[model samples]
Structures are given as structure tokens and as C-alpha cells.
Target: MTIRAYRDADLGAVIDLWRACDLIRPWNPPAHDIAFCRSSGHGELFVAEAEGRIVGTVMAGHDGHRGWIYYVGVDPARRRDGLGTALMAHAESWLARQGVLKVQLLIRETNTAVAAFYERLGYAVEPRLVMAKRLDRGDGQKNA
Candidate 1:
């Protein structure tokens, strides 16, 4: 499989891959997330293509100091093939080019497997909690 930047025509397949990997949730609409990433210019979205199909995806960004990774998913059928790692390495390289100092990713506490994946990639779990506030409620306006 080859890793590359996401394309406009890959939306449907990317969404389907996310769904197949059980990465979609009600609160975070995939389409809206994609649109935001594309327009906000805060990060890059990447995909892994195999046999002319999207088999994995990852979104990465940097805010000057540190880099963040999100929406990382590999097709269930293609998990052991290292596509996920390749995607992440690509992200790290991109972020490094942007002068980012550190890279981090958040995995649900219950998702031990995912945590392990990053651990294998030289990421260690920090003694910090992830806090968030929903700024958008999907109506093209910020939440009050």
C-alpha cells in the first residue's frame, strides 16, 4: 500500500473505512470533520491506498509547540500490514517539517489495543489528562 495525502474523491471510501473500523461516533460527524480539516488549514489528512482503494487514514496537525494526531484508523482487513504505522510516520515527518516539537495522540482509556499500537511506535503515555470543550455543534455556529 502507498501512503499519500487525502483527495476530494476519497471522501466516501474514507468514511466507509472509518465506519468499518468502528471509529465514527454521533457527536463527531465524519463529513463535518473532514470539511473542517480541509478548510481550517490547521492540519493535513492522509490515507493509505492499496489495490487502488483507501485502506487506512490519519489526520495530523501542529499548533507551533506540539503536534496532535487524530482519526487514525486502518481497515480491519488490513491491520497487520503496517499501514497504520506508515501513515503515522508520514504524519510525524510532516509535522517535523513544520517545526513541531512533540507529537501526541489521544486514545480512549478503554481502547488498550490502540494505546499499545502507539507504544510500539515510540509513543509513551504521558501523565496527563485530555480535556476538551465542544466549540461547534454542527450548525455552522459555535456552541454557547
Candidate 2:
């Protein structure tokens, strides 16, 4: 299989693979395709192709300080073939190139298997809480 940077033409297949894996989270809206493709940073979306078909995908983005790994997915039929690891390696390499000091990702608390996967990958869980507040249109209008 070949790993390469994503083009607009690969969006459809990438989304399909993600949906098939049930990997979409609440924060990942349907419009992430547009946002991801247009984002400017040290990160990029990559695809793993085999036989002219996209089988795996990952989005890796980094500022100078930290890196994020998001939206990683592998086709069910193609799991256990090391595609996930290969994709992660590519993402890490890209982050390293950008001088990012640390990489992090958030996984659902219920997904113990996923946590274990990352643990096996040499990532550790930190003792910090993640908090967020969604500002609605009303709030924006008030500020305006």
C-alpha cells in the first residue's frame, strides 16, 4: 500500500471509511472535510491506498508547541494489517519536522481498547481535565 497526502478527490472515500468505522465524534462535524482540506498548519491529512482504493486515513496537525492526532480510521476489512501504525508514524514524522514538542489525542472514555492501543504506542494519560464552552450565535451577537 502507498501512503500519500490527501487531495480533494480523496475526501469522499476518506469520509466513507471513517463512517464505516463509526469513528466520527460529536466535535467532528460533517463539514470537517472542507475545514481539514483548507487548514493551514504543520499538519496534513494522509491516506493509505491499496489497489487504487483508500483504506486508511489520519489527520495530523501541529503548531510549534504541540501536535494533535485526529480522525484516524482504518477500513474494517483492512484492520490488523499495520495500516494504522504506518499512518501514525507518518503523522508523527510530520509533527517532528515542524519542531512540535508533544503530541496528544483525545479518545472516548468508554473505549478502553483504544486507550490501550495508545498506551502500547508509548503514550501516557495525563492528570489534567479537558474543558470546553461552546459559544452560540447569541453570544457572538451579544459580544458584537
TM-score, cand. 2: 0.86
* Local accuracy by lDDT, each model: 0.86, 0.79
Error of 1 at 89 (Å): 0.5
- Candidate 2: C-alpha RMSD to true structure equals 3.9
Residue-level lDDT of model 2, residues 1-144, one tens digit each, is 999998888877877888997876555563574465447756688889999999998888875667999878889998887888899899888888878879999876676578766776788999887875557444533221
* Candidate 2 ranges with C-alpha deviation above 4 Å: 33-37, 136-144
- Worst 10-residue lDDT window for candidate 2 reads 135-144
**Model 1 clash pairs?**
none
TM-score of each: 0.89, 0.86
lDDT of 1 by residue, 1-144 (tens): 888888899999999999998888887888888887778776889999989999999999877678999999999988877888899999999888888889988887567777878988999988995666565555555322
| lDDT of candidate model 1 versus the reference | 0.86
User: Residue 19: error of model 1 in Å?
Assistant: 0.4
